[model samples]
Target: MNDYVRGSAWRVPVTACQPRPLSAFLSRNAQRRPASAIRSLLPLEQEPGMISLLAGKPNPATFPIEEIAVKVRLPDDASSPVVVAVTGDRLQKALQYGPTAGTPALVDWLAQLTSSLHGRPLPAQSSDSTKPWQLAVGNGSQDLIVKAFEVILDSGDTALLQSPTYPGVLPALCVGQVNTVAVESDEAGIRADALERMLARWDVDEKTSSLARPKLLYMVPTASNPTGTSTSLDRKRALLRLARKYDFLLFEDDPYYHLSFEEATPSLFALDGQDSDHDQGRVLRFESLSKVMSAGLRIGFVAGPSVLVDAINKYTATSHLQVSGVSQCVAIAVLEQMGHRGFLQHAARTADFYRRRRDAFERIAHEILRAEPPVAEWTSPGGGMFLWLRLLLPLNANTAEGDSFALISTQARRAGVLAVPGVAFLASSGGTSTYVRVSFSLIGEEDTAEAFRRLRRVILDL
Candidate 1:
């Protein structure tokens, strides 16, 4: 035994000690590595105007910007249709070579907003010695989502996901050839008991045992897709504990965090800040302006420890170069204009819109379709744009013996309603689920009643 491992403290440490040099540790990561071509020029990008051999960034001149206008038609009683002009130097930036991490102004604005809204420590990036929080921009949160997966998930590596997860993640994971293990979820997002059970016996699960150990937990903490559920603060804490205990990353997919039905469900990031030794560095959070603003803009961001973010950004460098300069500039301009309070108000507006739709849908379903209430149960999402419905159809109904996929595809479509099937969201051969996902965001007010009526009929027939 070494002297460091001696006396009264002569007892062996209960926890395993595994440490490696930063370079050695990183070299082990095969998933994300900066491309050789890009790595060679890092120092050059910092060099003083040396008339460069560098990024093949598009010439700003090629971008056409004859005119850009946004017309708002809000309710008459509400604030007069606010229309802001976009021109001058602003228009030029929107049509030029922008920052790699995002427009500096936009990055700064977002950092401030995240710090204030989530109540996280604002790292000072100036004369003050505080560690500055870094930022990276991407084309919509979806772009960031794919990049995050690329950064850590090796082909065949295990990724823990919530049961009845976001259907969007399915295709991406399939393309990556990654193995996912579903953790049963309840009204409060992923269930701690179920996660503990799955993780505890991971090495023994026939389906998962052959794959590389799971290094990530993918979850949408607020208004989860296919199952509009938000995990409570206590649940969040338990999850953090589990992550720390098992040594894995927590991918907090929280695009809908701001849309919570409650005044505050409190973000994992926010709660992590409460403790001094809080290794919040484990949770990588994702957000987007798509749900809050317009999905067309394709602007999104992720927040995590500098090391992980750097790894993901390196992938971004070789893959997409950077999110569009125009988009970043526009986002910055709009975000700066909205500020913090205005942004919150706008978020509330978005939430209010969805909540109303949810109530209407639930009311119609209860009155017309659900013969027994608890027989077909679903969490009333506190926020976001989805309502995951778990129907009470026979597990082995018709020729099919699983999800509402066949019914929705044939009957519902024939009946003129389209909803995502639950099986589409699960791991292949995971299990049978009598669930279906519905989105209120895409539908209009006048069409809601008819859509529900169609959906109700399909369930009644089942």
Candidate 2:
């Protein structure tokens, strides 16, 4: 027999390799691309101070608005509610449908804010476009994340998520049927070595082989969701280098960027030089005004290659038109009032407040509850709202044998203290966990002591 015929004898039918019509593909394939009306215009607007014949932007003059005042006392020494004002034509633009990507002024201000905060310049466009790496606002960071995932993950396509990640991303990926590869995280966030190993042996790894190649790696680089770990600068460089070597996208879900405990760690985006090398479309950084400001405001944005952003905006336009103009207006007003330094000061106060709470809780966990020779271990969050704790139970906690799910849900609730279970954070079923996630952002100082006391009792009983 001919070599080709003999080799092909063991192969499946040739129809498997035959090209099929687009109509035959799965529903996700039909809906794989991004949808955003506003995100598309980002390129045209980038025409470096170009005038508009393209955008149907409502003139600010036509918009009817005078001022929007947010009543909240500034942190620091300020003693009264600082009513930030949004006046003039700027207020009008904010109140109207405006642009799909975002209001020009707001996007500009955000780009500048990101640059100043991260110590990187605004991304330079490949071609001398008026706009470079611009901004597109969403209801919150979650909004942008859903949109971004839609743009990249197809049905059955793969994504890499750090194990014990934010619970929010779970449902979104599930609804889309995207296969998630859980990469274990160390105290330093998503393990760079694990990521590289997985990618290198994709075909060989039994866990990864049946799935499609992963097109994106999702991570919260600063104060990661459940672990409260941040990737070091060296790790960032290594991750970036590996992404370049492999050509997959890096979804940097960094809403807590400002809340980092390390005041001076380098941001992944800043290391990519504000994404000047669009080829490294490798890093797509997501930010939000939620955790730092107010979660109710529902404002967040993504910065990366124009191509990807445009895809996302396509999904946005077809669905939401644009994020609420009213929210955009309010956010722009607040940002303009705060500028860069004032904003940083406010953020620093918020971060410091959470840090203090973390310190207090850790001390109590060590002193009172752990006094009986310790029953749990936890990583100290540098900056962010949560402290992830791993309980040492006599039973098999990893398999949920002695997991805290029932303890916190039933016993702890009865005890008047509540927390999220570690199983909720685990992406897979078989993986064992003895961990529990606690949020310090919403809890008050007076309640903290009692809460830990209640938590201690549950562990002792277990």
lDDT of 2 at 91: 67
* Cα error of candidate 1 at position 434, Å: 0.9
For each candidate, what TM-score against the reference?
0.84, 0.83
lDDT of all predictions: 0.69, 0.72
User: Candidate 1 lDDT, tens digit per residue, 139-173?
Assistant: 87778878777766656566788877877777778
CA displacement after TM-score superposition, residue 30 of candidate 1 (Å): 5.6
Pairs that collide, model 1: 7-10, 140-298, 140-299, 261-382, 261-383
Q: Per-residue lDDT of 192-272 in model 2, one digit per residue for the tens? A: 888878777776779876666666778889988888888887888888776666545688899988887785677777777
Which parts of model 1 are misplaced by more than 4 Å?
1-32, 35-78, 124-133, 204-208, 371-377, 395-402, 442-446, 459-462
